[model samples]
Target: MDLFEKAAILQYRHRRIGDPGRCVGWCSTDSQRLRFDVLCRVGDTSDSQTLATSVSTMCPSSSTKRAGAMVIFHAPDLCRPACCTPFFQMDYVLASGVLSYRCRNALYPYKAIRQMWEAATRGPGFNLLAANVFEASHVLCGQNQHAILAFSRTLDPAAELVTGSVTDDFTLLMRRRAA
Candidate 1:
């Protein structure tokens, strides 16, 4: 698949929710509701641990889930350095009401990250900047989850806007069709 297509699939699989046999729970937003299930295998245990650690360091301990599977909701904001610059922000009503966000850390390529963020806030949902550092990151992460949501654009222009949940794996990109 092309890079954009691959990115979108990766975002969807990573942010997927509902009962996937391994994880199940309830999550809600002001106007929407979701159920999430995380599917993984024995070999993925270490990757799960790393995700837990990264989440813990960035968010409160209670916000982090360490088990092989669990559920949660996440809201996110995509902020730019200047006020006049367009920004992207949205909320992800996961199957579980777990508030999570991700910031566009310096680690990602600037152009790709900006495009991903634009694909989010420009879609449906409320536009609100998060309050705290953790909250901002949570929103940013939610935007990241939209990588798949953005890919859906390739299939149907009228499809509902997409959003994603945070995940540790990048291999999900291998499953998408090239443009």
Candidate 2:
């Protein structure tokens, strides 16, 4: 189908599933996903690209901005494996790099990020390292300061916790709802 068709379908799904169109997405493949079309950033790591998609200070805290600890979401053309590993790290740096957060490809138990901003001295990128061997289930990204959802046996997003995977349904939460 064409982009318009995909967009129409996405908007339909977003409204049905309860996600706002203001939600942006970025990936390294044509399947990154949005209510519109998919845009991938594979090789061109240009400064403009980084600036246009940086979520570093969308809802910034004083500490984060001061530290320049931007959580950049980088999605290559690879699908995240199932979120069942007790101890795993989505390393971004070559020798030893760890994402400020711990999440592989969000497509699995969570959803992927649409864009990012990185410093030159920081090297390539970051990784999503995680270790919860004691927990009996997999943890999903809940998109808030308390962004974690545990699943004991099923990865079904529709099961009380999730409406669907971030990749498929686009029911992702970049921020939390206020009380």
Candidate 3:
């Protein structure tokens, strides 16, 4: 099944998201019904302490000033089985509700990040993160968890557009874009 399918099975235990095969994720403007797609897992990489730390640090649960998030994100790379990354890229559109997986390529290079970022920072405490997907120094594995973490830390402290990804250790890291 696809990512959206996984989410639907996870959230609603079904495989229909807006359409049949072209689904991405779920989207809703309603504040009462929030969806957690980025936090879901598909394989052996399940829940752990590191994951909790990652989500809390990267994704802002809520803001003291604002009410909720404009966007929450994760990318499966540009290759088949897109795999998972530690970079959490979210863009929030005020009062527009959330939208998810609309196509197989929905997670393609710089998809919804741009539109959401533009709308999110229109007010205070609004932030957008950006980061480059880099290869880790390890010669044995293709896992880029460490690479993503290091990349996130190197971002500008004021970088509202940081990239978030799953760590090599199965942790999630979403922060403001590095400089």
Candidate 4:
């Protein structure tokens, strides 16, 4: 990120909510709702299952399940899984900016996050992988869609955009390739 963006983020983090001129990050309630709506639309919430990493917005118990589609989340610090399992052999995975982006105090390289998600998609019985990544690094570095293509693991072009825009942080809906 550039000096201005860094400063803006710092200012926003330090100030209280509703403070003037401060922008909300990916974890904000409104932002979460926006991303969740996209997921619901694209994932065919009527019958498909979902597994998320975070606890607040996407957790199974906290959020309503649509049409009996099982929704499960695991976060050690905040909420425990309904089945008391850390990771499920689920078919669908939904990760927000937190999983792939350098948010809060956790930082990860673009390639690392990309590889991780790709591996998860390749897991047995996995079907859909949906996520939105922080786009500042990709945009600021002038890499165009190269970073996004890499993030989606486009080695064989399996992932596609289901919603949102690529100019900023956007969502991607990917399907696992049949083995």
Candidate 5:
């Protein structure tokens, strides 16, 4: 099938699942909250200057913005350029970077990976947290499969995977390296 056909089928499947197009990879609201808590803790936003990538619903940009924090709030369907574009207009002096989730790439493919590299400086790295279930247990599972493959194809080419850990969720702290 072509891209449009694939998109239509995916939309149909989302409608049948009774989910908004943005709700990809999450099984429930509770699980989503749990993941958010983990991400916030891991990313460590105590310093007001810290920059982060967070789920728009889970982490309101307003709260961060109020505190003079720069956060890239990601929704799979909306804000595609913020999530996918390889460059930001300003020079972001990178600190040891924050964590990111790959579920956001379900629709945009590996653009997130490329964007992260472009956003960070040379030494300090960023974390990539992703989990993919291969079988299509439901419509969202197919999106997960797409995410898994996108990571496989794009991650190694973009950054050096410095350290990794896997449980129910997998996290990889990747450093910016010469391409």
Candidate 6:
């Protein structure tokens, strides 16, 4: 189908699913086309406040300027074997990265963030690290090491939890010690 046809279908589907459009964020191979279509439907009033509130409650520090739900895509065989489940998963390995707040905002907490990451990684989903290019600085500067160690003690016992410079190439893979 053409871009317009696909957008119309998505809109119809979204409406059928009770998703009011305003509060939904989509990440697809054709992001530009999707965004254009969504914007065209901006005239339709949808209360995104509730979604913003929920997101704020989970991550209180996150900016609510344009808060919305994320819809990720995961193709087969791209994620870890354990992630091959019936849940909606994103391909973190192929993702550019994620953008999150440094501190807990109104919507989420440290525990919640860790749980989400663990859950995503444990299943057939996106790689949180791969989807989050800025995680290195955000975690290191935000002292997320302590949080990580606290939540997953068995993963890194001798973690020093020191402040480090944030680099573009920073990935969670380097935080591990030799086995």
lDDT of each candidate versus the true structure: 0.26, 0.24, 0.25, 0.41, 0.37, 0.27
Candidate 4 lDDT: 0.41
Model 2 scores a TM of 0.20
Supply candidate 6's per-residue lDDT for 120: 40
Cα RMSD (angstroms) for every candidate in the order listed: 16.1, 16.1, 14.3, 8.2, 7.9, 17.7
Per-candidate clashes come to 30, 6, 35, 0, 0, 27
For model 6, what is the error of residue 144's alpha carbon versus the real structure, in angstroms, after optimal superposition? 3.6
Ranking by TM-score: 4, 5, 6, 3, 2, 1
- Candidate 4, residues 1-179, lDDT tens digits: the string is 34554555445444534542332333455555665555544344445556564423442322345467666555422211222233444555555433332233222334333443444443211111123333344212222234555556554365555434222345555555667
lDDT of 6 at 162: 19
Which prediction has more favorable lDDT, 4 or 6?
4
Sorted on lDDT, highest at the top, how do the candidates line up?
A: 4, 5, 6, 1, 3, 2
Candidate 5 error regions (>4 Å): 9-22, 47-72, 76-81, 89-111, 121-134, 137-169, 175-179
Cα lDDT of model 2 by residue, 1-179, tens digit? 23453354345334434233332222322322221111111112323212112211122224333444333443322222211122323211111011122234433323322121112111222122222211111221223211323321122232122232223222212211123
Report the candidate with higher lDDT, 1 versus 4: 4
List, residue by residue over 1-179, the lDDT tens digit for candidate 5.
Answer: 24554465456444545453344433455544444433333233434333344322343323334445454444333222242344543222121112222233344334544564455443222323333423433222222323433463454444333222322333333343448
Model 6 Cα lDDT, one tens digit per residue, 1-179: 23453354345434535332332222332432322222212121122211111110122112222343232233222112222234633312111122222223422223433333343422111112222343333221222333444543444344222122222221132122324
**Candidate 6: 10-residue stretch with minimal lDDT:** 49-58
Clashes of 5: 0
Runs in model 2 with CA error above 4 Å?
1-6, 9-57, 73-148, 152-179
Error of 4 at 39 (Å): 2.7
Per-model TM-score on C-alpha atoms: 0.19, 0.20, 0.23, 0.49, 0.44, 0.24
Q: Which candidate would rank higher by TM-score, 4 or 5?
A: 4
